[model samples]
Each structure stands twice: as structure tokens, then as C-alpha cells.
Target: GEYEVLGEIGRGAMGVVYRARPVGTNLVVALKRVEASGLEGTEAVRRFREEVENASGLRHPHIVPIYHVGEQDGRPFYTMALIGGGSLEQKLGQYQADPRAAVTLLAKVARAVHYAHQRRLLHRDLKPGNILLDEAGEPQVADFGLATKLDPGGAAAGGPMAGSLPWMAPEAVRRDATLTTAVDVWALGVILYELLTGRRPFGGKDRSEMRTGILQAELIPPRVVNPRVSRDLDAICRRCLESDPDKRYESASALALDLERWLRDEPVRARNTGRLERLVKWTRRRPATASGLTFLALLLVAGIVAAVTMANEQDARLRQEVCRGNEFAARHVASTVLAQLQHFGEAVEGTAASTKLTEACDGGDWPAVEELLKARLLDTPPGPGAPPFATAFVLDPEGIIRAECPQRHRVVGGDFRDRDYFRGARARADRPEGERVHLSRVFTSKNDGLDKLAVSVPFRLKSGGPVWVLGATVPTDATLGVGGLHDKARKAFSVLLAPRESDGEEYVILVHPGYESREPSVPFPAGRLRPTETGFAADDDYADPVAARHPDYRGRWLAGFAPVPGTDLVVLVQQPYDEAVAPYRAFFRKFLEWLVAAAVVGALLVAGLWLSRSGHGARV
Candidate 1:
């Protein structure tokens, strides 16, 4: 380095820039010394010489002209004009305050870049530090440290990797983009953005992030950061920073014209830009925002899946619970109804008056039959809380009501052939002695006008000479007494008792909570009401019951069965689907609300953490 070093003017990762003079010449110069020992070997020396030649190739008033190049003591040094006004980096505060003046300076710098492009020179490292201002305050594009010669045919400029990472055009960084004047134009755009906004477009915390930002990050327009920057300048800056090299200005000369237009208050060449183009530039400049949005979108999707799965699982669990509760309830109801039937059957057998009553009715002694019915049949009170019997009548073999005991209303000669109770007793007339009484299939009683069950037994005047049927009708609802079991706090349920056979072979409604709540006064029309199933008494163990559909309710109900002992009767407890699954719906709704709140909080926490960590390492 054959120069008298005056003082350190600046220092960078490469080496130190100093104010110096040649051994023989008294001319003041800015000297950059490439310490080969640190740079290591022939490649560093070659690159050092290239930097000098690249600057010397083109001569222009606004371009820092290289005056000398040489090597001494294993070191390489180059000399250019001593820009007393310092780098554009230091002048940013002053120029950013007056955007018009800043644009004027950048326009001149752009022309200097165009001059180098004319000579097939590409100054790929164009940044604020690379641009200098002379004593007269005229901008001079400097630092050809990473410059390359554009191919004469405008093909790619392939050489050693070079350029300021943040300011380098994406194609130049890749070293595959065509080595054309557009590369210099892109660098000029970065310089102008820094000069006007007092900030760089890329704010990545590391070289890797910087490279990505340059390649794909959005550019924050000059006007956005600094309102003093006009829309024309904003558009001009974007045109140059285009990710596609082809989309950039054809040459630095073209960029200079657009910037000049802004200074002249005329519309810029980048006027064709639209919202989409601006948005792309903004996205590129803010990589963190894009990545954060992508991360939250994924979290949102995952949360939705989790909520749906949780709701389904909860629904399943609630249904199982409802089924278990209904199982216990069904057995309780079945036992109660069975007990009432057994009690009445025993009373009839123990009373000798019942046999006398049957004899009197068969002998056509109407007066004695009436007295025997009152003394033997109606005297056995149905006990406390038991469903009262509608009537006790003796049906002769011809199926006529002979005598009604303590009975009101009318004719003792009423025909009983069509009645369910009479038919049921007659059917079981030849039943074995052990299987004494017959339990009638459930039916709506025409007398009391409620759900009723007929339990009957047969007797002979003289050892099967002629059979007579003795029967009683009991209201099934009062006998079962299960309406209150349909607890709101628990779950909705229905209870049914269907005798083996007797009435149309259809198991009938005994105590349905759904029905009672719906039509308390209006009786279910007999034989018109459809049964949930047949052969309920044959079921041996708990199984999935058939779903019963009723238009009186919201949805279908699932039934669970329990058979009563020593009887052809099955008790069923049922529940609607919605009621069974209500708990699940409530739980999932709360969980979803909490999940959404947590997701939003998590997103904010991550974003804040990133900002806190990145504040110190922001690219200058």
C-alpha cells in the first residue's frame, strides 16, 4: 500500500477505508486497503483488482472514479475521490427530512449507475454505505467491491459471489439472474428507498433472513415509513425492487427518468402499478407477518378438529350414561307393576265369596250375583296408592256383563263380547292350574279413559261344565306411577308394560312420560296407538332397543327393557336423543369458546416474543 494514511475514514467487514495520498502524488484520495493476510490468497487479490477495474471502466461526474490500483507487501489497495461529505448513510437524516432534495440526489446517482451499465458494469452492492457525496454535495455512486461485468449479450454475470445481501437483487444473489442493467436499477431502488425513508427495505436479523427478504419479502414503500415521500416516489421505488428482474426498469437510465419525474412533480413511469403489486411489495418487506398468519391459520384448523372430536366423544359418553340410568329405572317400574298384578290375583284365590259369586252368575240368580259381587269382588280395596280398578264384572260364557258390583251408570245386561278384558280371560280359560291368572295386553279403557291393563282368571260351575270369566280393569298409569321418574335434572324417559298377548298382539303404552306431558286429558285412542315393538317379554338381557318415533316429540327415543318375574310382561324405559346428549352440547360449547380465546392469546404472545427478540438485531 504505497500511500500516506491520514486517518480512518470508515471500516467494514472487508477492511478499512482511509483518507490517504500516494507516495509521489499530493492528491487527496479515499484509499481502500485489502489486507490479503486476512482475506487469504490469490482469490482476494483478484477480487480486489476487479473492484478497482469495475469502477474505472466507466467515467461520470456523479460516479466515484477510481484513480489508481496496485499491490504492495502482499496487500491490495485502490484509490478514488476523497468524498468529504461522507457516505449517503450519514446524510440520510438530512435528506429524509426534505424528500424532494433526496430524490434529486438519488436521480443523479441513478444516472451514474446508468453510465456504468452503458459500459457493461453491474454494481451489485448498491446500498446507502456504497453511495458517497462529494465536497459540492453532489451524489456519487461508489464502492464496486462486488461489481460484475454484464455479458455483452446481456446473459448472466457469473463470477465470485458478491453484493450487500439486503440490497442485492434476488437474481444477482442467486447468480443466475441475467447480468443486465436491471440489476443496477434494482440496487438504485434500494438506495433511494433508504435515502428517502431513512430505513432499509429488508429488516431481517441475519444474512439468511436478509437473503430471503430480498428474494421474497415485501417492500415497505418509502411513503409508508416517511410521509414526506410521495406516491410517485413510492411507485418508482417499487418498480426497481420487483422480485422478477424483468419487471424492474430496463436500465438505470429508465429508473433515473422516473425519479426525475417525482422531482418534477410529473407522473412517474411506474404509474401502471396497482393494489396487488403494492401488496406483494408489502408482503416481501414483512416476512414475519406472512409467516405468523400462516402459523395461526394452522392452529385454527387444528383447534376446530379438536373441538369436533371432543364434542363427539362427549356425546357418546352422555348417551351411555342415559342408557345406564334408564336400565335401572326400567327394572324398578317393572317390579312395581308385577307386584300389583300378583296382589290382586292372590286376593281373588283366597276369597271363597268369589266362587259363590261365579255360581250365582251362572245359575241366572241376578239378585244373589249382585250381593256376592259386592261382598267378594269390590270389597278387596286396591290398597294405598294402587291404581283403582274400573270394575269387577262376571262375564258368562256368551261374553255378557252379568252383574256390576257397587257399579254406577247403567245396564247389567251390557254386551261384553267385543271387550278386551273378556276376550283375554276366555283365551286363558284352559291354562294350567299353576299359571292361574291371565294378564291382558295394555289398552285404553273406555270406562276410566286412561291407559289400562286387564288381569283376569277363569272358573267352572262344575268341573268344566261351562266356563265363566272373572276380570278387573286397572289403569296402567296409576299402577306404574312413573311420570315423576322422567326427571329434568336426569334424562327424559318412557315406561311401557306389554303383556305376552291378549289384545291385537300389540304391546301397549303403560306409562309414557312423553305422552302424559303432551296429552294429559286426551286419552290415547285404543288400538290406534302404534306399539314400539312386539315380544318385549322374550328379551333375556339388556340389548340395544328399537328407536320409537312419535310426532308429538322432537326426536326419536331409545328404549331399554326389563322383564317382570312370573309374567308375560316387559317394562321399557325410553329417552330422546337430544335429551340424552344435552350435557355434551353444553360442555363442547364452553370448550370451544375457551379454545378460541387461547388461540388468539397464543398468537399474540408469539408475535410479541418475536418483536422483543428481533428489536436488537434489526437490519440497519
Candidate 2:
């Protein structure tokens, strides 16, 4: 023997693989030997040779590389890279709990399969058992014994239908059906489904039942089986399991691409987006300012593809990109708004919780509390990091404005019991001392006659006295406040929507694009400026990009929403869909015109050559 057989690693249908070291070398390798039963005839020997040939032809980081081939005692054997981490089948438990890891591993495997496909080789028996993982958990495709070169039609031409039964495609089960790369995709889908849901998409008692299941059983969506599975992942898995070969991903590469998109938090081609999820995904992706550069790069790539695809389809792709861009922008702005709101809320909470302010309120010192509020207000200067609050005030247990910053003496004794800010703070008095602050609904100030939003916290004055509320108000139209949603282009802007008090209640827009220009005299009702799809369900639908016309805004828009944590405020970023996509559409139109002109020129040249040939024949 030319090698020292360390031990038998595993056995399969046709042969056994062993851990061995070549004779005169310290290197370890996997040496596979054909069993006596497998080497019974010339056909078996040829199959053994073919496996080595097929595996050797593939050169990829994720594919097992063949090292040597030989025979011993009339039994053929071949040596290849020794993978110590074992097969994917042995390590399936890790993926059971983490669908993302499963997807990532499968994506790499799918790429290896795609590599083989590009070389006209088909891995007819792709399964977890055949996928070897290295020590670092990187997947390396192995066992290409069933691999066959693709015929002229890009399908397996002849030979008996062979593949792992459980992971086979419906077409593969039908012996006479043409087999393409789709069978491998079907297996990849099965692997993904099992990883996501911890169970196979189709199961049965026996081979016949399994075939029947593959051919006819309805695939339970991955999300339905495992509630934790995301909608995007479910869609990707379902697309791979589609019974119709044409409906499945056209190639293994396409399947891998969809998986990559899911990992990147981008909209996958497995399903149409432009739904609420797209916006939600953008938050996780943390869309950066480089989105424009990303779009430009995508545009360059698309221009190259424009040559093969129809101009109309190219135009659609461009629009899709723009829609995504709008979603990204909206998500970015929403995050900024949420951070700012959280900063303000923290400041208000911190000031109210201070020992000095607490001592002033804990005693019968309304004047002292008023002075403390004024000093605290000045501490946070009116600059970039300043709180948006224009005035800070203290109210007695009777809801009387006891004292206020900048000393509005005329309103010091005014009662504000009916005000939402006062009521909101009082309502939360039963809560823990640290958690007693409340963000009130939008309302107009009685004294200033201007729209105001308030954050109020409840505290007790003198252990014997009833609880008092300390509050701060930000004018709705303040330049640096939520109401100041200034979008210079008017194409896109951010709006702050106050959450509904109860189910089925309308969501009021506390801030809007034109809030600065609105008349101060006209009273704005709480429900007057409601926007559609502002409910909790719509805000939570995070698997699709939200692109539709907002009824209140009166135009089709691509929007993204983010909820301000620990508060009832929601930030909505809306971009007019048409305006966002216009530039891309114009570029596509120019590309289409060039394509048409080139076609016309080529046609004219052909016609001219034909006429000259006819005239030359007449002269002869």
C-alpha cells in the first residue's frame, strides 16, 4: 500500500473513506476506496473513475480538491483533502437554532454548486451528507460521483434518474423529465427549510410517499412552521421549493444571491418588496449616507446588464433601486429623529429627578422650584445640542401654574387641569418615581395661542402635600423642534405621529411638512391630521418596503417608520415616489434610445448590402 491507513472515517453506498497518511509523507488525507461489491464490473470501475475526474475538474475554495488516484488489490481508490469538521449532517443542530447561520453556510455551498454548474457539471446528489465542513466551519462540497456533464440543452442527457430521494425535485423524481441545475436548487431550498424550521418541508413514510410528497404536497412556509423565521427567509425558501422548475430560481447562483440579500438586509428577488418589511430591514442595515454611491455603483452594473435585458425591464429595475433609495433615506432620517427625541426625553427626566429639584418640590417651596426650573433651562443653552423645550414650568397639585421659566407672571395662577400634559402626568403618578414622566398629545397653548407639545413628570411637594407635575413645552413650530420638518426640495420629509390612545383610534400627525405655514387661529383637532397606515401593525410590518400614496399627503410615497423607544411617538419619513425615481427613469430612457438607434443603423446597413448585391446580379 502507498499509504498508512489511520482509520476508517465513514462508509457510503459505493465505497469507504479512510483517514490516511501517504507513504513517505507526513501529510494527512482522505483516501476513498471502492468496495469489492462496487468494483464487481467495468461499469462500477468507470463510475469510480468518473467521480475522481469530476471532483478534480472543479477548482473552488468551497469544493473538495482531489489529490491523487490509484488502485490496490484490484480495488480502485482516490485521495482528497481531509476535512476534520465532518459532514453538514452531523452538525445540523447548530443551524436548528440559528437560521441565519444556516443561510450563510448554504449560501457558500450554493456558490460551490454554481461553480460546478458553470463548468457544465451537475451534482445530482447534493445533500447535507455530501457537504463537508472544515475545522473553521467553512463548507466544502464533496461526493460528486453522481455528477454528470450537462448536455447541449443544459440538462442531464441520459442515464437512470439518480439523486437523494428526500431532497430531490419533483422533476427529478419523474424519470423521463429533463434534469437541470434546478434539482440542486431544490435541494438547497430543502436544506434552508430544514435549517429554518428544524424540519423538512416535505416528509413521508417511505420512498413512494416521499416522492409523492415532493411531487404534490404543499410546502408549509418556513415562518408558519417556525414562528421565529422571518417573512423574507420564508419567501426565499418557498421560491426554492416551487414544484414548477421554471418557478424555482433559474440557477443555484440565483438562490445564493437571494440568501446573500437576506443576510445583507436588502430586498430579495425571491419575492416582490415595497411593503412595510423593507422599511424595517433598512433600520437593521443602518443605511448610511453612502447610499447614493451604492446606487450609482448599482446603476453601472445595471448598464452592463441593459444590453441583454429589455429596456422596459431595465427601467423597472432602475425604479426599484430608487424606491429602495427612498426607503433608506427615510430610515436614516427616522433614526436621527428618534435619537433626538430620546435625548430630549432623557434631559427632561434627568432634570426632574435631580436632588435639588426634588427637595424644592418635596417642600412647600413653589418659588424655589420655579427658580430651579429657570436655572436648569439656561444650563442647556440654545444651540445644536440644546433641548427643544422653550419653557419649563412647575404646577401645584391643584393643576395651577404656580411658577414658570422667564416668569410669565400673568399666567402664574392660571389653572391647567384640563390640559393634556397635566392630565397625562397625573395619570402616571401611580407609577414608580423614576418612571413618572409622560409625553402629551399635541395641543395649543392657551396663553401664547401657539401649538405646543409637552413632556411632564409627577413629583410630590412636602411629604404631606399631594403630587405636583413639573413640565416643559416645545412650540410645535419651533425651528429646531419636531414641528420643524423642513424639506427644502419638498420631495421628502419627516413627520412625528403621536400614537393612538386606544385601538381603532386615529393617529394624529403632531408634525408635518407645512406645520410652519399653518394658521395659528384655526384649532387643529386631534384626529384632523391622521395619516393612513399609522397603526401599530403597519409600523411593525418590517419585511417589505412601504411604498404607497398617503391619503393625507395626497401623493404616492415611499415611506419608512421608526418608533421612539419608551414613548408613544413614531417618526415617519416620506418621499414622493415619483420624484425619487424620475432621474433614474430619464437615464433608462436615454439608454433605450441608444439601443433603438443602434438597431436601426444595423438594419439600414443590412438593407443597403442586400440592394447592392441585387444590382450587381442584374449587371452580370
Candidate 3:
């Protein structure tokens, strides 16, 4: 027959197997050829012939049948049904074993070994590598050269010792020079252990370590390595690896019976220790892998996002609190100023002598009224002059300054007709018995000085006609504390008061403390003041430059067009972003440290388990 030889299917210690197609049927078949070098002498040749004869007699479906055994081209050769699906070892490595699939495949292998045993043939090597998977993925045990015929003195010279050392039974390792089905049972247990845990039971760094460990050390519980393995499955694996052959299943059939029972949900004969059983249950409950860690990381990220959202909410609330506090203070100061103005109006109205201007207007005759005004209507300690009035003045219906305190820089003759404060007061005065003390909107003073707030009240004569306007001035600085001029972090803040124009534009009127003189100063037009988005005109009223930039200026500052309680003025407070959230920053850093630490600990645990298993495999 014209058979085309393809490639080698697999190689073993004794021979090589090749895939080939027969010419007659064009069907694939595996050919096993014993190397001539391996059959060195007459004794080796005789041993090869014996193995061939033994393999040719096996006819089970799970056992690879030897179709022909002959001498081809001066080399001993044999042909069998070629397994299209390759070896069991390859499948095990490629696909992680599902418990059901593992049990099914294992049961098939056990059945094959049992059939061989019943036929008086013991397969000394029964490992995954020797178990071939056909095109249908069914297990077919091959490489029966190491098979012991179970007849006294019929086993080959090197047969028992020829199998894989790691899969060898304890009796085989000790060179007990015996042939028994128990050896096959031990190999089956090792294969089951490897399938469940992805590793060998007993192994360490070197061959010596593996040999010694396998003989002395206890196997790592399968559930410890693979939590998916059931306690009953683990018990089955441990029993097969028992040192004493007497303790092992009597035969492959008996082993298969127990495996079938386990598959059927029936309890096997094997006993499970309390801790080992608990570990198996735990593994089934939650696999000890990075998947859990991955889930935890996702939860942690979600928590962090939630925490950040809450922090932002808290930050907004704190900002509102601070703003509300400043507004309350501004209203309190304005109310105090309004009350003083009302008192001043009553005193002037009550005294007819004071209402009429005497020809000689000397300081001593008006001392009592002057003293009264200075004492009640001025800031305490009043510097070193008559007094620093708490309100700025605008006069009569024409809107001009009549009298001012701190007599050193008298503004009595100054005209303020174009100012918003004067116009607003004049309009109020026109009303019949209108508001006696009219509060004005916030505006910049034409006087090239720091920003000041003005308060005006009409003086009604005995004849029922308006006489003059009495008022007072309060500097922006005195109303808002020096600390309030800077941010909470102590960063410097700038203020500018500009007049609003009819064209909707505003022009700079006064730079507080003359811009250049303030500490930690801000830049401004040095030459002549010009109109700008930030600039205010003399007749317009607005908040300081810093306050104007605020989105909540109308609601928070309580100054400007809206009159604050006690007085009419706006107050602004600015702080640096870093200083505003310093506490939160510190908290975030601590949280980050804890998160990193947790990740490190989790990674270390995973790495340690991985390395330990790798080391165990290396020894095996």
C-alpha cells in the first residue's frame, strides 16, 4: 500500500510515532517505529518484539490498537490508528479543565486502563502525555511498550523504571522491582492532581528536592491552589497518591467505580479533613485570584468619585457661608450709619437757633452741637481732627458738598451734581414729605481719594421748604477690615470704584488708597485714568474692582444698587484657591497613600502564590 508519511505525531523514550495516510483507503493512521539504535543488542531487540506482541493483542476502543508489527527497512516498526486530535497533555495545557470535563476525561482514561488490566496487561505509564485524544476528543491510551503482561517473569527488563519519574508510584521510585496495577493507579492520581491545580503535588527547586519531597513532604491541598476544585474531587486525588499500594484502589476498575460515584453526586470512600474541606468550600465560594482584586479596585474608584462629588458640594457650602457672613457685616455697618444720620437730622430740626445762620459763624458758639455731632456720629479715636465722619455728604437740590468732617481737607464747596448718590437723593427729596434720610447707591467719588460711601438727609426749614443737606463720609477701608482686603491665604487683593456712564460704559474715578500706595499693589493706568470694563465714572456707583468680578456680587456684597441693612454699600472678600482648599488637599493625599498601600499588599499576595507554584513545577 502507498502510504504517505507526514510528520512525527509524538516521541517517547523507546520509539517515535508518525502520522501517515494509507493509499487504499486514504485514511490517516499513526505509525510507531522503534529506533534501531534503541534496539542496540539481541536483548533489546527481544524486548521490543515482546512489547509489540503485547500491544497487538489489545483491542479496546480507549486503547490504541497495533495494526501491524514488522521489520521495515532494517528497523522494527508498527502502525496504528492515527489520533488526529494530538495528545491529552497538549489539550490539558491549551484549555483549562472544567470540573465536569476533567472528571469525564479522567473516567475514560480509567476505563481504558481497567480494560488493559482485565486483559492481564498493566500500562506502566498512564500519564496525560501517553493518553492520546482522537479527532472526537476521546481519550485513547497509547505507548504500551512499557506494559507489563502480569505473567511471572513476562515483564520487560527496563519496563517498570522506564515511565516518567515524576508520575512514578512510590514503589517504582524505591526500585521495588515489582510489576503491579498499583503503579498505574499512582500515575492516574498525579494526572488528576495536575489537572485540578495546574501543577504537580510534590516538587521543589531541584531534582533532588523533588525526589526527597515527593517521598517525604505532604502534597499541597488541591483546593489551596485551585479554589474551583470540589472537596470530594480533592479527596479522590489524595487517596490515589497514597504511599502504600494497599491503601490505593485495588484496581483501575475500583478507581473508576469511585470516580463514577463522585460524578453521580454520591459520596466516595475517601475522607476529607475539616480544614481541607473548609478550604475547598471557600475556594468554591470565592476564587482566590486577581478577579476579586479587580472588583475591589472598581469599587474603590467609584467610592473616590463619590467622595470627590461630596467634597465639591461641601466646598460650595463653605463658600456660601463665608459670603453670607460678609454680607451680614456690611449690612450691620450700613444700618449703624443710617441711624446716626437720622439722629443728626432730628437735632438740627429741633433747634431753631441752629437753623438760622448767625452773621458771626465762630467755632465756640456752636461747640455743643459740633461736640455732639463728633461724639455720636464719628468712628472712635477719630484720628487727630474734628472727626472722620462715617458718611460722605451731598448738598441741597443742586447736589454739592456743603460740610465734611476731618476739617483739614474740607470738601464743603466741592460740586457733586453729576454723581448718582446726589441725583438719587435729590429725586427722593422732591417727593412731598419724602424719605428724610435717603440712602444712595454705591458709586465712586470724583475726589481722587480712596473709595468712600456717602449718606444724605434733607434739612426741612420751619417754612416747610428744604434748607440744606447734611451728610457724612466713611472710607471703604474703615467699613471693610484690613484683613478683608486680602484673601484667607493672605494673598493681596485689589479694589477699584468706577462711575457708570449712559453709554453703559464705566470710567475709573478713584483707586483705593491711590493704587500705588497700597501694600502688595496691583497695576493700573499710571498716567491719566481712562474708561475700562473695570473703571468707574465719578457720577456712577459700583462695588470695588474685586467685588465687581464676583458672579454673586448682587447677592453676596449687599452694596451697589441694592441697599444693605443699616447702610448702602457692597463688601467683597477674595482668597487664593490653594489656601481655600488646603484641608481637602491634605485629606486627599492621605487617602491616596492608603489606596496605594492596599494595592501593593494585594499584588504581593498574588505574586507570592504565582512564584510558589512555578518553583514547585520546576522541581517536578
Candidate 4:
């Protein structure tokens, strides 16, 4: 029997939703029906089934539940729970004049959308219209019929569906349909903008115009539209709506965390606008006076000088610091590689002992030797514990793998003799030098497919020949501890590891924690290293002469380089310049302020004395 279709509840480009009750149960639900005539028959059926299957799998409280799917009179239909309240679009219109209520409501919707994203589903059609409010005013995200699973392989070919264009991310509009969680982030930014400013960030009369605006137009800052919104909030919104997907928050969780942090009065994760914004904010808050103007001018001049000086000092310090950090990380990673090699060596030695016995009993069993080698090669290492390094790969002296801890099929017989680490170790071994570990200059790995630090230690065979050079490869990302180095000191400070090239040229290889925000100065060569700057040079007694002439720079930063134990690399640590120099900046500001006050007072006294003298003369 054909299922009965009830009154229409909502309609859109893809389908129409209706109020319906299933047979025998009398259970009321909202049924969505897609017109088969409007789309390709098999493709439409597949899409409908996929949507139903995907939507049914989601079990979050914020997401609307999909109940059942079937055909009624040759048309596809899916039923979902009938959410009782109006859509968020209606709520927005109802509360158009109230910014606080709108922001609060949109934040709730963001949370729901974020929940869906956590499950790897993107509500590609995330607009106020798609979000429905329940009786208790909780947002329930509906109409996932247009949602797409974030499968990198199954990305759609065309531009995002037209209905969702207003809330679509710029990349989505550009039809770069990788459709990451960043799309959701962009939509949330639009919602936030609309909520605060009482209007869509980019609006036009038609879809084409809207798409054009979204793809090309810059977002008007929330503060520009609504003066009451704080600069911090504006910054957050701008970050979310950044045209470049890479610049946007990586995920909805990151966005939600930032928003929650902002609400809780915690420091937000966003870019700082630096002294320009600070100066503007200061000027806006102050009264205009002759002394005040002079003070402001002096302050600006001093700040520019300080920033330039800091940049120079930072350039040198950053290289040293990155070198030190990478060197530290390299040593740890090298140790891990060394341990794996030592284990492999033991395995090889054991196999050799067994093979000798087998050979003595059976006239030199070559097949048995081959089988033993294969078995030892195929043996997997134990689970890597929480080591300081990210990854460990091993290579023998000929740059061939005897065994690698993180076993990969590609590196087993691969030749690495041309690699710097291999060449350096072999050269050292040719000198009949004692088995020593040589840390290769930090360079991006050409064979391992990542930026890596290579540590090579030569192993001598029983015949006094360099049999194998054990090379350990540690990926730079892993060594730097991606996103795991956040600390109070890191927040106000920076650390870097710089390595010197063969000709004594230093350059930055690694910067830990918050390198993106501070934009630390490190003089890495554009393509190749320059002479006179061999990686980072450590001077425990290093002092900036320019800073020495200016007391403000005294004790602003303490820097020292220590050789990464067991490696030629150096680790440099720089204390927080802001914290170290806060006292000085504050003192200088106060001193200048008092000096201006004193000068003003002295001028007034002189003027009074002259006036009194003139009055005495007139009386005479």
C-alpha cells in the first residue's frame, strides 16, 4: 500500500518535507520526499539512500533523527522526528533587533554543527533556515539531506548546491570541493557575523551575485557593522572567515574551543595585530594635550626603534634557538634509532651464530642463511612508546636498511649512500676513526619525504671493515612536537633550533610552540645557505651592542646554546623578551611621563615669574 502523504511542512530545491504518520503505529514524523523526475533516476535513488543511511547512523541529540525511508507512489521519501519549534531563520527575524539573543542562539547552533562535524558529517547547507529550535529553545540541526560525508575520495564535482551558497566557504564557492571541516567553520563565521551585525556578511539580490560576493568580497568587520562588538570577537570572526582555507581554524572543535575560551575570559588562539592596534586603542582612550601628544610621538618613535632592534636580535636568537631545539630532538630521535639498530645487530649476530651451526652440520646451507635473513628482516619491532621523537627510520652504512623500527617496505633495499649522513659517516669511517655518531646538518629529507634530522653512526664488522652505517631519520614535525609544546613560557616566549651548513652558515630549522603568532625572525636562506652564517653559533656571553647602548634592552632576553648531547646539533633557548623587558618599558613610560610633567611645571613657573615682573614695571 502507498504511504499517505500529509500536509507540507517545508520545501526546498532538493525536496519537500511533509507532516506524516506511519501505518498502524500512528507515529507522527516529518517525511522528506525527493522528486525522481527532477534528478537522474539511479543517481537520485543512490543519493537518497546514501543520505538516509548516513543520517540514520548519526545518533547525536542536537542532530535531527532519521526514522525510516521508502518509496510512496514511485517517489522516494524519508521520515524524521517532527521538531516542534520554528526554524532559526524565523527566530532571527523575530529577534532581529536583539544582538545578544542572536549571538547566544547562533552559538548554540554552532555547537550542534560542531557536534555533527566531530562525527565526520558536514551539514553543507548550514544556514539559519536549516537549524530548527525545539520547544525548550535548543537548536536541532535538520535537513541533513543536503549534507555530505567528508570523504576525500567521494568529493562532489560541481560547485556547492546553490541553496547553501550564502553560508558557503570561499573555497566551496570556488568549487574546490574537498569540503573539509573548514567549510563548517566558514559557515559558523557567517552565522556569527549575522548574529552580531543583524545582517549577512555578504548579501546580494540573487544567487549569482551572492556567490560572486562570497568568493571575492572581504568580510566587513563585525565592529564596523556593530560598534558594540569587541575587537577580540571581531578578530575571531575574521579568522574564521579568512578567504584562505589554511588560515581558517583547522576544525570545528578548534573554533568551538576558541569561542568557549573567549566566553570564559581565557586567552583566545588568534593572530595579534601588534603595536599598530595598540597605538590606535591607546589614542582613542586618551585626552589630547600638548604633553600627551609629545609623549605619544616619543612612544611611537621608541616602539619602532625597539621593534627594529628586537627583530635583529630575534633574527640571530631564533636561529640559535631552533638549532638547539632540533639538536635536542635529534639526539633523542638518534638514540631511538640507535636502539633499533642495536636490536637488529643482535638479531643478525644471533642468526649468524645459528647459521654457522646449521652450516657445520649440513655443508653450508645457503638457503637456510637466506631464510634466516628474510625472517629477521620481516620481524616487526615492538610498539613505539611515547618517545621524544615523532618517527625513527634506520639505514645501514651503504644507506641500505638492515632493519627499521617503523618498518616500511620502501626502505628495505633502498640506497642512501648519496645522502649527506651516509657520506659523512663513511668518510669518517675511512679515517679508521673510532665508531662515532655524526649528526648530519639539518636538512629536509629527500628520501624519507619529510623535513628530517639524520643521525649516522657507523658499525664496524668483525673483519675491521665498515659494514653498516646506521642512519636514523626523524621527521621535523614529530621532532618539534606539533601542537604539543604549549606552555605558559611558550605563550610569552619562543624556542628555535638552527643548524649550520658546511661553510659555517646558520639558518632556522625548527621553531616550537607558537611560532605562527609571534612571527619570530630567523634568517633561513631563500634557497641555499649564505657564507658567514654557519648554523646557530652559541655565545653564552652574547650581548647585543645596540641593546647595551640602550638600557631598555638590558636583560630583555637571555640566550645560550648547548650542543645536543650525542649530536653535533645545538639547542638554543630564549627567555621571554616581553616579560624580561616589561619592567624597563614601564619604567621608561613612567619616566618620560614624569619628565613631561616636570617640563610643563617649569614652563608655567617661568611664565608666572615674567608676568609678575611686567606687573611690577607697570606699577612703577
In terms of TM-score, which candidate is strongest?
2
The TM-score-based order of candidates, best leading, equals: 2, 1, 4, 3
| lDDT of all predictions | 0.68, 0.73, 0.59, 0.59
**Per-residue lDDT of model 1, residues 501-525, tens digit only:** 3344455555555443212222222
lDDT of 3 at 296: 60
Model 1: how far residue 47 lies from native, Å: 99
User: Taking the tens digit of each residue's C-alpha lDDT, what string does model 4 give over 1-620?
Assistant: 43466788877656778888776677778988775465546666666666787688777777888877777667778888888898877766555456546556656666777777666677777888878888988778777766777665423333545337788887777777466777778888887787677789999999889988998887789889889777777888899899887899887767767777667666778746476788777767543443455565575567657755765586556545544553354344434444533443343334333534234223434344334444433343312332233233444445665444444455556676666777776676644333354556655543454445555655454346444554544333312432323235443222344464433455554444333322322444323321124343433333322232335334544443334334444444444445544555676567556656765675566556656867898999
Q: Identify the runs in model 3 with alpha carbons over 4 angstroms from their true place.
A: 36-44, 93-97, 152-160, 272-620
Expressed as tens digits, the lDDT of each residue in 1-620 for candidate 3 is 34677887767656777888666676777877776575545555666676888788888888888887667666677788777787878777543458777778888889889888877787777788888888888988987777767764333233335667778787777677665788888899989888887788887687677778768887787888888888888888888999888888887777888788888998777754467678677667546454556566786787678768877787766555544443344344335433444544343222212433221122223334334445445544223222244443325445655444434345556776776556655556545443555544444444444444455555543445655555554443322222233332344232333233222233332223223222221222322233234221111122334333334322222121112234322222233344445677788778867866776787778767767877898999
- Listed in order, each prediction's TM-score against the native is 0.43, 0.45, 0.42, 0.42
Cα RMSDs, all models: 33.5, 25.1, 33.0, 15.3
| lDDT for model 2 | 0.73
Question: lDDT tens digits, residues 362-411, model 2?
Answer: 67587887778777654573335544466888788889987787676766
